[model samples]
Target: MAVAPSTAARSIELPAALADWLATHADALDTSPALASEVVPRLAGAGLFGAGVPEALGGSGGDVRDAIEAIAAVAERSLTAAFVFWGHRTFIEYVLQSPNQALRERWLAPLLQGEIGGATGLSNAMKFLSGIESLQITATPLASEQGGWRLDGGLAWITNLRKEGFIAAAAVTSSEGAPPAVIAFRSDAGGTERSADLDLMALRGSNTAAVKLDGVHIGEADVITHDARAWLPAVRPAFLGMQCGMSIGLARASLGAAHRLCTVTRSGLLGRVESLQAELARAVGQMHEGVADGRFKSAAAPLFRLRISLADIVQQAVMLELQGSGGRAYLMNHDRNFARRWREAAFIPIVTPSLTQLQMELQKQAAAAGAA
Candidate 1:
């Protein structure tokens, strides 16, 4: 990726009013684990959710790249908060891009207005559609009496979901040769089951939980888009690309902590730490370039490699923080919350197109090249 433009940061800048608020509240946000429903209104007041939405739909109207920067900023403050932003943005993208004009008109405004926050099942759905995993959730045609479609089975687990909110769900039809579909539903809808939050190893503050749909009803207006076999490839790149912002922000924060420790200790490892800083700088530059130019659709290998590299870098960054900080990091509330960043590192690899998945995919590509 090209070195960040001199003014490139302007692209991801948060609205002025919001930035002012964040400067004041950044510390509290980093330490606490408040519920999203409590915080979403705050996000709305800042006009934060509309970054990627169309002006006509009450969004501020930037593409995915703009949204990525905005979310990344949130990540630096709180990765949990960033996940909420991404989930909302992801759901909005599905709705706005769908052929369902009526659905877009009905929910798009309120969604951006922060009246609602939602969850995404896209990660697992994409995996199932791509044949990496069996479908955990399945869809069935509705009976004439019930109308609309029925969604059955449970989504394994999804982050950024609220106890009561909207959900953008996708599932493959359990029919031979049938394509998968993306649909919307209320989390509290009839026959839908929302489980308690999982005891996650990381991102526990993200309000993650399991959702089971036992013939949940969805109307024609709720079908965000179908033909998942055809649609997923078109959207996967952007979906994955947007994740880079979060990684960059987390990496930057981790590195900063390491710097603080190194400063106090005046350690010899400063050179090694500086190398990580250089590596992250290079990765962030390349990520933004690839994402802005939509290169993941073509030369995605570089993008994948960079994404995994960031994951690895965050681990090293946190390790440096721990080494430099010494016993202080073991405290329950270390000044920098270095422990949280350490936990945050666990999330990147397991996320879809996870490190293992990335390596496996690369192996497959290598095999294909040899055959060719």
Candidate 2:
């Protein structure tokens, strides 16, 4: 029998221990790799890893909105940790709903419990070609004793490869006569290798890298979703939920910086700082409403829109904070709230579909709706 999607009770209230943990360790997760390692395990222990999973599968059984809120709270403290956790949770959710039962028991369960880390290998094999050039990786059946199939190709940019125990990747499986399929694989499995870490502009702690699978053996158990087209709809929404958390984190940091400047600076700049704070408040309120209502298609559209807006808001807020506080805000040792968040926000729009692509999609959607 096929496993049903989780439907456990949702825990909306934030536990006191979790709140205190975020407050105490947020800064550490940002600046210290050791602290991140420490915190990630704790987060998993606290059941935060299962926030987006179904209750039947040992998750909190919450909706995407709850996951967004929890991630936003985490990001407010540590964007790096939050980003990693968000990506991990998104992939874990994908595995939980996958058709492969053995894969779910071996990979998804352990991952949610924080026993293993997982990364996505799909982005590496993705090509933006308008038509036929879109897919870059292929999976071919292997003839050797290892059994299953072999994946031969690479993904362009993959995140969290260094730490993950398994990889969820997409590969075209075909010869001359068969249709292509997307597949998932374990990191320790034969034929899988991760390249050196990429020099990223933001989310440095993500350990993003390129992954190559050279005739790596895989079986039916490794396939998360055999039908790529059917999987896209679910994956897109989960990613959008994470982006919503990222925007909330960026906005919160920006606003916090503005508040700090207002409190420390001379009276002359207080009015401008206050205005920026109010604008940020409005933006955050809108974000909250958007997530809560399930509007923007489970927060994907709003998150994408907020990503564009957050980048601008963070930049402007930083400028205003520096102007209000003079050179103090620029001190290398001082926390550069706006600077870090602005840089992080930059990654959100460019990571996959990209801002330009999202805008064009929105425009096309509008045009299609008008015709309807």
Cα-based lDDT for every prediction: 0.71, 0.62
Across 1-372, the per-residue lDDT of candidate 1 in tens digits comes to 111233464245555655565545544444454544555666667777776666677877666666777777777766767777777777777777788999888888877777776666788876664457877767777668867777788876786677657665565464435566777878778888878877766565566778888978788888777777667666766677667667877877878877867877947768878989999888777776776677776665776788788888888888887888889888877664576677677786787757887777777778889999
Provide the RMSD of all predictions against the true structure, rounded to 1 decimal.
Answer: 3.6, 5.4
Q: How well does model 2 score by local distance difference test?
A: 0.62
Ten contiguous residues minimizing lDDT sum, candidate 2 = 1-10
| Model 2 lDDT per residue over 1-372, tens place | 111133422223445676577656555444444443454566677777777567787777656656766676677666776777776776776676677788888777777766666665544232221122467677777677766676787776766564546465565646543555667776787777877666665565565677777877788888776666545554555565565576566556656766666777656667776776677666655655654455654335565566566555655765665675567666757765545655665565675656666676567667877999
**Sequence-dependent TM-score of model 1:** 0.88
- Badly placed stretches (over 4 Å) of model 2 are 1-39, 124-133, 143-147, 171-173, 176-179, 263-324, 336-339, 363-372
Kindly report which residue stretches of model 1 are placed more than 4 angstroms away from their true locations once superposed.
Answer: 1-34, 174-176, 333-336
The best candidate by lDDT is 1
Predicted structure with the largest TM-score when compared to the true one: 1
